[model samples]
Target: MASSIRDELLKVLIEHQPHFLSGEEISRRVGCSRAAIWKHIEELRHEGYEIEAKPRNGYRLVYRPDRVAPEELAPHLQTKRFGRHIRYEYSTPSTQTLAHQWAREGAPEGAVVIAEEQVQGKGRMGRTWHSPPQTGVWMSLILRPPISLAEASQLTLLASVGVQQGIKRVTGLPIQIKWPNDLLIHGKKVCGILTELRGEQDQIHYMIIGIGINVNTTSEHWPEELKKIATSLAIESGGHLHRATLIAAILKELEEVYQEYLNSGFRVIKSKWEQAAGMLGKTITARTPQGLITGVAERLNESGALLIRTDQGVIPVYSADIDWKEI
Candidate 1:
């Protein structure tokens, strides 16, 4: 198929780095004819790669695209197997949806599904996640942890910590994790994590952690309603960013944290997450299905639920809408 040909061509380009390969030579290596090789070269060029084709010299890949293709990401990703099996899609309904199907079909742990654009992306509480074309990281990672359902919420915290670390490493931005799983940069929403699980009474089948980061998108790219609250990496850093590099870093960090969580306990990650939490020890209001509770955010329980000290008493919140307030 086209992808197989592209991978072979990419291997040749990487080996030849800054050199050129004749059309005939490339065709022979790829098991394709010269005309077919040229066609694939044109396709790569259309995907934002700068390939130079001379009269008789050959074809040289002057520049690779910044898109999150496996070849582009694999070089930078340092994880053992997190992104080793990545399914990159130029456009899709949602990475989470695709990942769910893969998980159900027994995809291996650390399998990643990423998309450039999501037509039906989702946020928490059935909200629509804004995923513009080629401007953000819309990814879902499949994890099959040997844990119970009661401890599933900890994965959200772990993912938030991973994202915060990845962004900080790449951009050096002072990002903070809001309660549950929202990444904030300069007090605006920059990333969101949605954790979905499938399991039985005492065992877990698999967990799909979907993460969305608004990278390289500007304020104008957002919908009118979200312009005031939603911000992107370009807006925050005042420039464009390489999406592929960021995605690779994120997967690497996720793999590290996930390994630690599996080997150790959630205690270590919980401590780190609380330190990076935005509203810890601060007065906040949480809107729950039962009612509104005003309290000071205290600590995270073992199950990763938010523990708040209210005027009435200490309460453990499993899930709620959070808003920070000035005390």
Candidate 2:
């Protein structure tokens, strides 16, 4: 019936876990009629939560589906503001587009927009992100950082570090951050971060940081062209993963690092980012607007630009497509 009642009922069921909760006890705790409780329980089952009902025993939570919905993530989420307000869509053109719309409409900082699948998922350099249904994490986060417009791009680096740490915490995978906005595992792409902002000369109004992660995807999920370059946590870890748990972990890690970036500066985040960086000290080629330049990857500047030491000199690349095949 009502969302509040459904939430309460689910909360009670989840809190009790394998132990059964009687109908009368659940009704009292959720402040709903037994009939309503039954209706919602059926609904939960329909949504993929397994509930076992015995003759005398009322119900026990058996299993929960791998979903990134607010209710599903509530148990694993620990951030104070990040993910506090979520807009979940079963299917959308793009979470980034929705997040930008919400941010423009004054949505609070830390509001997240998640989609099970993105028909027109956005990616770096005007590319499209592959987001199959129930396969990956396709979501965007709204932030109102106090940083200036020129410094807004740094959030991409910060988010990359946060997401890599979160994934490592969950699966113990050696997720590494490629320069700019890509995450790799076993030298294959697993995640991408895109940070877009609305700001003036010196101030930022808001920002939408879109994060796409390949969690449970497999060989069949990838197109022939992408199979060689893309990968998933399940593929790398040799097991399936719960998408909600990974989302919660990413949100918690992002919020923690974001707060630190605000309190101190980019120095702390920059250092952490370097540790997880995958391209440093390697020979890589960057396709900038000017032309293709190949060189030894040096380090990132304070502004989040990648510095490559070419035969000519050290060049700071603001935006480009990285080709690390040389590495």
Candidate 3:
């Protein structure tokens, strides 16, 4: 993918950090005119880069923005595919909705849509997700993996494990998975994953994998009833976690784990998911579309279904609102 001229200009500035290069030097390096270089510098300033211009000295990056925008994450991203193309915003109703629309418009695979705040975010069962401004990782990724629709739920499991790994790597906090979607720390919810699909029955078009992690959120940020249930990386670790770093780590881990799955099948991912699940012998009630069912949460079956051993016998739960009410 070809970068915009402004991006090329920003690259030059970042490459010469801590020392200002002349306008003529920048133009020579980027193969653009002095006027074009000045135009790009103004655009970079608008993108939140602190560039200083001197009479003879060129631009130098004093500080970079704390945003998850393409320019912000481009320097930090290590994954070859994920987040290579991004659409970033300050506020939106939902990144997942925007990502789906972008996919329909022929956005490339691994395209990502991220927002600093989500006003109408939702999770499984269409439950509202609290996403205040600049407090969490609210993003969606588009995947065009070579997997069948029957294997869709596995993507959720893969992402859940990826997030757990990423959070652990960044904060050293041991987070656990609560079955299909929720991530728990000290028995409180910290993250959620929502995976949606598109395309014909067999021919896949795209998959939208949405992950929302409460990074810098504090206890006071939660409402009264949610105080005991929802927590954050900052709350768990007692320090502020960089949302961009976590996002990069998540995309990297997700791509790596997913690549492994693509080559070796679901065995490895399923095993990791089970170990991170932390709910094998426990019993709980889950609210499904049919009704509430109580059973001992046994283990993940082959297809990533939650196998609950009830009195009637073992049954596979494909989707549910896991009762975290007591947690």
Candidate 4:
């Protein structure tokens, strides 16, 4: 199959790095013809790999692509199923849109769809998510967990925890999670998550969780409206980061946390999220469609809804526009 052949080609390149391997030698190792080897090399090149082909030396991997293709990301990913089957796009309208369609078609759990750019990406409450090429992580995860709708919100929380841990692991930047699903570094927004679920009355079908992180984008790359409130990994870390490594780290973390969630409940993940929360126990303003409510963010309910205590009463905020500066 073409997939197996691609995997074999990637394996050869990864194992025999820097050293040039002749087409004849690769063909022998992969049990394919010299022409087949050349075809695979061309395919890899088209996928953004910078492979150098010499007259006699054959192909040498001069540079690895930063894109999150299976060939480039498989070796780095440490997971059983999550992101094991990756659909990577150079640009798309939205990873969420593609993943939703796949999930509807009975895609397996932990399937991942990633894109380098999204022209019409959406966030919570239909807000526009800014996704430029080669600047952010635009990906979606499809989950077919056997849980009730009430329990499904925990997936967003679990994803937020996973992203927080991943960023800390890869970039060593101390980032915090804003309730629901937002990753903040230095009190600015760096990442956002939008979770969509499809199911029957009581039984669940699948959930599509979309995550967008501004990785290498700078202030100038963002529109003037977002530059003041948005920050990227490069700005926070003072260096350019390998996006593939970050994606791998995130998939690993997501797999681990998701396993834990399936075994236990959201208590474990909720505790971790609350610890990393940026506004717990602090007074903040919740801008809801109804009206603005100034309250102290108390804690997360069992179903992962935010509990806000106002002067009048305790309100369970399913979703809200949060301003951390008010805290």
Q: Over the stretch 1-327, how does candidate 2's per-residue lDDT look in tens digits?
A: 498789778878878998999999999999989999999999999999999988788999999887887788777789999999999999999999999999989999999999999999999879999999999999999999988888888898999988988999999998888888799987899999998888887999998999999999997988899999899999999999999889999999999999999999999998998898888999999999999999998899988899999989999999998988624
Clashes of 3: 1
lDDT of 3 by residue, 78-101 (tens): 898999999998999999999999
C-alpha local distance difference test of each model: 0.88, 0.91, 0.85, 0.88
Ranking by TM-score: 2, 4, 1, 3
**How far off is residue 193 in model 2, in Å?**
0.9
Off by over 4 Å in 2: none
Of candidates 2 and 1, the better by lDDT = 2
Model 1: ten consecutive residues of lowest lDDT: 66-75
**TM-scores for candidates 1 onward, in order:** 0.90, 0.96, 0.87, 0.92
Tell me how candidate 3 scores on lDDT.
Answer: 0.85
Clashes of 2: 0
TM-score, candidate 3, is 0.87
How far is 181's C-alpha from truth in model 1 (Å)?
0.6
Give the alpha carbon lDDT tens digit for every residue of 143-242 in model 1: 9988888888899999999988998889988788899999988778999999999888888899999999999888888889998778888888887899
**Model 1 vs. true fold: TM:** 0.90
- At residue 125, give the lDDT of candidate 4: 89
Each prediction's number of clashing residue pairs: 0, 0, 1, 0
Clashing pairs in 1: none
